[model samples]
Target: MDFSSKLLENAVYEMSQLPGIGKRTALRLVLHLLKQPEERTNLLSEALTDLRAKVNFCKSCHNISDTEICEICSNHKRDKSLVCVVEDIRDVMAIESTSQYNGLYHVLGGKISPMEGIGPQDLSIVSLVNRVKEGEVKELIFALSSTMEGDTTNFYIYKQLEGLDVTTSTIARGIAVGDELEYADEVTLGRSILNRIPFENSIKAS
Candidate 1:
């Protein structure tokens, strides 16, 4: 019969629950944490404990924030007429890092994945539609991932915004197919944004 303490077993189990972490990695982490000073372990515990307590979603954009509205949404320097709709907060960080865009952001929180049981209702789509309906935005940029799920989500958003005065478009297809915006480099992402194409507009033989 195994005699491992329940606390240690619980720690390993919780760590293993994180994506990409397995039993072996969790055990290694637990062992490493055990070797750390009490202060280190305490710090980790306190940070995790305070994560949900300190972080709040921005009411306007659904981005993680400490205040009611995220700094990006509140900033007057940002271009209020343009809203970049992305899959998550990570994409916001990626775009911000480029220092090329001056527009506001709307984090959808996730893509529409029917198989995964995630749909527009599961995301911040309603808030996004409401924000656009306010009529301040002149352009809507779809900065979602290039995957099938991302495409599905973008199309859903497009249909929702149909007939709005706002012009809709997406970042150029320069980004590799299936490559997530967060994992893409700054130059590629910046160029992709700079070279965005208009939605429903086509260049045909004159």
Candidate 2:
């Protein structure tokens, strides 16, 4: 696309770099931002800048946070012994919306996708194993999506926790095959969490 102003072009280009945003959508967004008051645009820019510079990952679960630990991890009422394993903060948010689980969470960062060059080491699996070894976590709920990579990551972590006292479970198939947890309806997701089965049973069924 051609632009009369290079500033507009630059803004659209940067905005288009976001996932699911095309050049056309980015251009429209840039134009909308340009139409807004200068203070509003400045606020947007300042918010993005602050998000990138000031955000911290929770030391315990690796969820994005403003402090060293996320509110969920620090919440005394949450079940610390029941840790839900998820891909990232989005999934954490998805599960939290269900309000069916009172457990803590462990964000793996991503699944083990060989096609994408993401492996066990690329995720926060080691820290998870350490958490399990520390004997605080009594059960691990594998809440990753039902994709092959997700299953692989879950099994890899399951093996790492082999012979350990912690029990392992996976969310029920209320979520369709290959579906992401973030996309599932709150009711279905809640039911899945409530009806989670043993990791070994999931392996046998697979």
Candidate 3:
């Protein structure tokens, strides 16, 4: 390939590596980007380059933030005594879209998957425990998936907070089994949160 062709090929390859994008889609995107004004293309490239430079995970909740703490964490209107535990930031976005929850969130960063070599220690469970140990938390709602890893993580967290004063609960069955919390619709997720059940009682009643 010539110089210009080589640049196109590189762009296509990089775009194809993104999730849910294949070669054809990547080629289409590259062609679209190429059609934009030179300044617009430059801005796009600079934004992509600055993504890592500008964004960082909030230390308190582990959500993506531009500053030390995310806006949610800094908001005084949010309920500080209640926390919703989720697997990742995408799940946070899903729940936020619902506009029904008023509590803070704790992002686990990942679920506990022994088969994939991810354990409780690999997540932000310890940080969550520390947050609870502060004695300000009154409730912990587990919004993890209903998958094996999700269940394992939920149980692990329950065990960790066994002697705490706070109540532990999990989202209701509004979401289908084996589905990710991030993929659940806003209405379904909101309903699940509103109808959450105590984790301990849920297991015993099962």
Which one wins on lDDT? 2
Kindly list the per-residue Cα lDDT of model 3 for residues 147-195, writing each as its tens digit. Answer: 8889889999999998889999887678776789999999889988988
Per residue, candidate 1 scores C-alpha lDDT tens digits across 160-184 of 9888888998876667767898999
- Best-to-worst order by lDDT is 2, 3, 1
Q: TM-score, each model?
A: 0.82, 0.83, 0.80
Assess each prediction's global lDDT (C-alpha) against the native.
0.89, 0.91, 0.91
Instruction: Looking at model 3, report the run of 10 residues with the lowest lDDT sum.
Output: 1-10
* True-vs-predicted CA distance for residue 79, candidate 1, Å: 0.5
Model 2 TM-score is 0.83
User: How high is the lDDT of residue 127 in model 2?
Assistant: 96
Q: Which ranges in model 3 have alpha carbons more than 4 Å from their true place?
A: 1-4, 175-206
Which model, 2 or 3, shows the larger TM-score?
2
lDDT of 2 by residue, 87-146 (tens): 999999999998889999999999999999998889999999999999999999999987
Poorly placed runs, candidate 2 (over 4 Å): 175-206
Candidate 1 residue 60 C-alpha distance from true site, Å: 0.6
